[model samples]
Target: WVDAPNLASRILSMTQKRIAHDWMHCYQYAPVLIETFVETPRFPGTCYKAANWTWLGTTKGVGRLGNSHKPTLPQKNIWVYPLKKRFRQILCSNVQ
Candidate 1:
């Protein structure tokens, strides 16, 4: 949705700060990544790409509500923004 002024990047920065602040205050630990989904058909996720978020992949279009394991929902592209440089290490650490 970033047209010209590039509000998405600013919003993402603000959101990251807010998330870090809230999580640190509530749980004493902050999250390592921020993930978002974009419907590729409708939106090309240009905002995320412009903000330097990494593209992970596309979803399988599966709904997690019932036992039906069919691909019913619309597929969405996955993107992630790492809050920390060592996010992989932090996420994969066994010392938790």
Candidate 2:
């Protein structure tokens, strides 16, 4: 349920209570690993990050074809950490 930025905050807050009760309770701590399926260019995840979520990695490019094989849909990307970990890593990769 990736919502637009404008809608994320409102939706998160609105669902906080229930989320904490229903979802959060699943683990002892408030859950640290947060994975999501991101295929669409438009997704509202900042709000989730702010709430303490982690992004893993993104899916491969588009579908692929092979001999007598069906093409597969693009994988769902995963963004971890409230700070967009993957992006930061790329930015700092060349730093000394």
Could you estimate the TM-score for every candidate? 0.83, 0.38
The best candidate by lDDT is 1
User: Which tens-of-lDDT digit does each residue in 15-35 have in candidate 2?
Assistant: 543443555467644422234
The C-alpha local distance difference test score for the whole of candidate 1 amounts to 0.88
Count of clashes in candidate 1: 0
Clashing pairs in 1: none
Clashing pairs in 2: 54-80, 54-81, 55-79, 55-80, 55-81, 56-80, 57-78
> Residue 56 deviation, candidate 1, in Å?
0.4
Candidate 1, residue 85: CA error in Å? Answer: 0.8
Q: Candidate 1's residue-wise lDDT over 1-96, tens digit each? A: 646587888888788769977999999989999899998779999988888899999998896784688888889999999988999998899765
